[model samples]
Target: MTLQAGTDTALAATDHGAASSNDYRTGTAARLAGLPVETLRVWERRYNISETARSARGQRLYSDAQVRRLSLIKQLVDEGHAVGSLARLEDEQLRTLLPAATPAAPAPARPVKVALIGDALVRRLAGGGRELFALDIVGACASLEAAGRLRTSGAEVLLIELAELSDAALAPIAALRAQLGAAAVVLYRFGASATLARLRADGCIVAHGPADLSQLVLLCESARPGAPQFADAASIALAPPRFDDASLAALASMPSDLICECPRHLAELLMMLNSFERYSGECANRTPADAVVHRDLGVAAGQARMLLEAALERLARAEGLALPVADGAA
Candidate 1:
């Protein structure tokens, strides 16, 4: 779920907790179904996935049935179903598309082959003087270029560390993954929330980089499929704001040639995100666990802000409106 959706629904969570036990607003439905709100909107716009109902107040709402249906579709899409194909399935037919659940057989024991990146993480592991669990370090190197020289192609895991992460880091990292042929990756980052969301969305396992050796190893272990990725469990948290209050206000008030409320609405959404981001930071001060949770929330919020900001920018450009002063992530 996007930070917006997560915060919106999380604030309004009900007691009933199952796949299909509650009516939900759009954001809540998206959160429960594990789909981004934009993706949900796209599916509805392009495929008519559900004939959603409206509340008495004229707000769109999703039934428990619709939420469950979307969840099933999301799982299928993650497993490689084309969205268009799944959109055409009837509710009953869609249920049938899900694989039958059976008892999970114990996985065969084998040492995981892992390639390491980053000198600090490597030294941290080595400096700890610990024997890792079922892990075989195939190649340990300081940079992706050096790893290429190590010839650890087809390694099962890629464990990397970065002092700071940005959206730009993904491309090079992806290239390294292709070269190394790593099936799973664990990233330790003291990085931007916006970057973390994009990374998580692309299916990378991310963790706070300051963890001790044992914790880092466990994070790598969680990267393997079905091992309960903690980063995934963390989910993307509340996001930080990209634009400040004044900037959003100016953008919201700008005179425009376009005949729509979208620009203003986008600004309003961003203001809400900004408020929540600040709220999350304040929440972080209470305890260590809160710090982690709020940090994730801030990351989710930052990512969400970036998405809305792009939309606002496109509209501003299309309308030839004067833009507000730009700002960086908070």
Candidate 2:
């Protein structure tokens, strides 16, 4: 009768009681509910949706019923129900409002040959293999070194779970793709916005967390040979600011009072442009098509840096100041 934060509301009747200590953890619950851990905490804090148990160390332990309730809430929210209104509804009442759960799509004719790089994801998928009949996990490796020694596994797809994106991490993945002739490489990570463009440029399919297993499975199904690559126009459109002739002239003719500030500002702008230049080069080298876009971006950044340096030199001359040494120049 009483609904508590982190406790199962609707599925409590089926389970006949509260969640046991050995049930789902906060991370597992977040994955199952298709919600981030931070979002889960906020829901508990604000709505008291489910009551969770605590471990000796005070870690939140979610029961199976609680996870199910959270999943239902996510589904309802996706269907346009506000969490504030649904927070007070009982399981039966919420179920009445929800459309009947649809059956999963039938498995593909040929099971996808998948190689997993993350241990946690491998365990989750291996444990629930029956639920994902469309995927045939051929290999699971903790690192690229292990993947290199794997013999007799013809995995067509690579599923990489990374904590963050970096050139170092991607180098090995590129080698793996070339070695295995992989048809697709999917990346799963949280807070991927910062590196999403670079990852896409490297021909990766990115899934930002906390994504559900079903969603991950769907990504595998969708990643196929000759499939259209991922593109985010807004992210790609982000480039260094370009100044017109008039703006350059205005900066060149700035008042003597403000001319002193020009060099420092130009130095900062040059640093940013150089950073983007490196990023574009990395992306361009990833694949052939990537060369087109990233090359253009790199060229633009390089030209901007040069022009800014020239402007800085002019400003210095106007103010009778010495020119700062340009970055990477003798």
Candidate 3:
């Protein structure tokens, strides 16, 4: 059997007979369901779920009938069903039961494992309602790629947390988009900005409010079976970035008197300055390299340099002298 990205590909393949008739040896069932081997044992021993015949060596071998039952059990569990309750369910009962729990409210779509990247906002919004595989940005992307290759839980949409996105995080996001194409790419930003606009231009659907986001996801899921679509929900006005007092205090306390202005220190400072300068030039040129910093740093032209200067001024005032980088030498 061959594997490929997207569930449709697998469903379209000619190996359905082979997959359905495969023997349910211990490892085979677990491999297909992507569940733990120990889970299989627990369901059988503790829950009386899977009844298997043992060989002379005492190894359990399940029938194809058992494998199909176990596969549904895994899907249900992954969708957040209580394992104990599901283990008691027969195959017919489980199928009737899954549709209600799988969808957010109405019709149950096919089981598509989505990898949520960034903050816990997506979890809170969905309220653990769907079969979501939550992973950090890095892990989520890796899982998406793997699922695409395996044709099991291929990512149909990405729920990205812009507030949590760092300068380093953009590369993986870009890679995912390049790999997945103009699929449903949902980005949640702190507020509306040129940065969000840029992301939208690069084929992202931007949502600034949580309410709007929840609705947008519903729409995207609805559109999945019908047509490829895009939305300019970026028109939704949003508030500016706000920091709490504790966060402000923490930012204030970061630069210390230990920041040496020696030649070595100055050299490092100059390198950083030069790097930022080069980054700015590349950004102006609209090269792919510019996106490296654009997504990771979220730095804007004109204002960013001035902001850096202002920060150094505050640091110098706190330290009671000119900082090495602030001086012309750096």
Ranking by TM-score: 2, 1, 3
Query: Tens-digit lDDT track for model 3 on 120-173?
Result: 443343332212211111113223333333222444555555553334444556
The per-model lDDT (C-alpha) reads: 0.64, 0.61, 0.46
Candidate order (lDDT)? 1, 2, 3
Superposition error at 239 for model 3 (Å):
39
Ten contiguous residues with the weakest lDDT in model 1: 5-14
Q: On a 0 to 1 TM-score scale, where does candidate 3 land against the true structure?
A: 0.29
Model 3 weakest lDDT span, ten residues long: 130-139
Q: Which regions of candidate 3 are displaced past 4 Å?
A: 1-113, 122-127, 130-152, 164-171, 180-184, 212-216, 222-330
User: Clashes in each model (backbone N, CA, C under 3 Å)?
Assistant: 11, 7, 3
Each prediction's RMSD over C-alphas, in Å, is 21.2, 14.9, 16.7
Report the number of backbone clashes for model 3: 3
lDDT of 2 by residue, 133-167 (tens): 34556556665545665432566778777666665
